[model samples]
Target: MSKISFEGIGEVAATFACEAEVQAGQVVGLTGDGTVGPCESGGRICGVALSSEDGYAAVQIGGLCRVAKTGEEVTPGFAKLSADGTGGMKKDEAGGTEYLVLRVESDGMVIRL
Candidate 1:
């Protein structure tokens, strides 16, 4: 059997139409209409919005990005994170996606997607 493994090269970002108003630095998810919008609690995260302009947003899909927290203290290290339902991230103990948390600051935490 042939084996193959895929790894992301580097930071990846893409532009997408917004389903609704999205601010920069907010975590977004794919909407039913194929547009991007603020991710709801426990929703599958698509990427972090780097900029929002003209009904569109530039989202970072890979590599390190800063994300707002849901006021829950999370120790810096490896942990699972999920949407906070209001454009922020939270420590998900209930089988969420895992990411490497590089640092925890008062504003937000740096995570490698």
Candidate 2:
């Protein structure tokens, strides 16, 4: 997929090789091999996958991006987010990186990474 960029929303995305199949909107992280893959629980988030084909994926690394969520409730505000181990996001009270959640949609939340 091509890199995604928006005029004023500050969206930043880049293409990367994937270790395995990654669906769009799934949270992903850098693997030990430096390839991107679905993030595991507590894994450091690299970005949200915008598109995936073959062994490459377009990952949104910065700015507002929509992503799936776990059963845990998330609201609009600043909150720590981490992978749910199955390509979804969950609130991370344990703390580390904090992302700004702009809105909670029926499908997912819009967050600024």
Candidate 3:
């Protein structure tokens, strides 16, 4: 397995749409207004999923998830994908602070942001 970084609207868009631009196992760092928006269906940028089986255009934040999806889910408004020292960033302060724990696998764990 390998790790990758995805930034800006396009990369996030590709992941959200589950397009060929992205694939499983690639960690995406999302940053863009289009990557976030309000969804009447799920409220706020609650989660991400594929728009369709063959749609290139991914729904920014909460566009309207039509399919039932299951995968590693993350939401922090904006972030950068890193493969070391947990799934999130390092602490700038003296003490060690942490967020985003990396999990290898789970059958069906539910999380909220």
- What is the C-alpha local distance difference test score of candidate 2? 0.80
Go through the candidates in order and give the C-alpha RMSD of each one to the true structure: 8.0, 5.1, 13.4
| Number of colliding residue pairs in each model | 0, 0, 0
lDDT of 2 by residue, 1-113 (tens): 22543222788899999876688878999985647998878877999888899999998888877778876788889988888888878888895478888777666777888
For candidate 1, write residues 63-83 as lDDT tens digits. 877788875688878988899
User: Model 2, 86: alpha-carbon shift in Å?
Assistant: 1.9
What candidate 2 gets wrong by more than 4 Å, as runs, is: 1-8
TM per candidate comes to 0.84, 0.84, 0.23
The whole-model C-alpha lDDT of candidate 1 against the native structure comes to 0.82
User: For candidate 1, which ten residues in a row score worst on lDDT?
Assistant: 1-10
- TM-score attained by model 1: 0.84
Question: Model 1 off-target regions past 4 Å?
Answer: 1-9
Q: What is the lDDT for 3 in model 3? A: 64
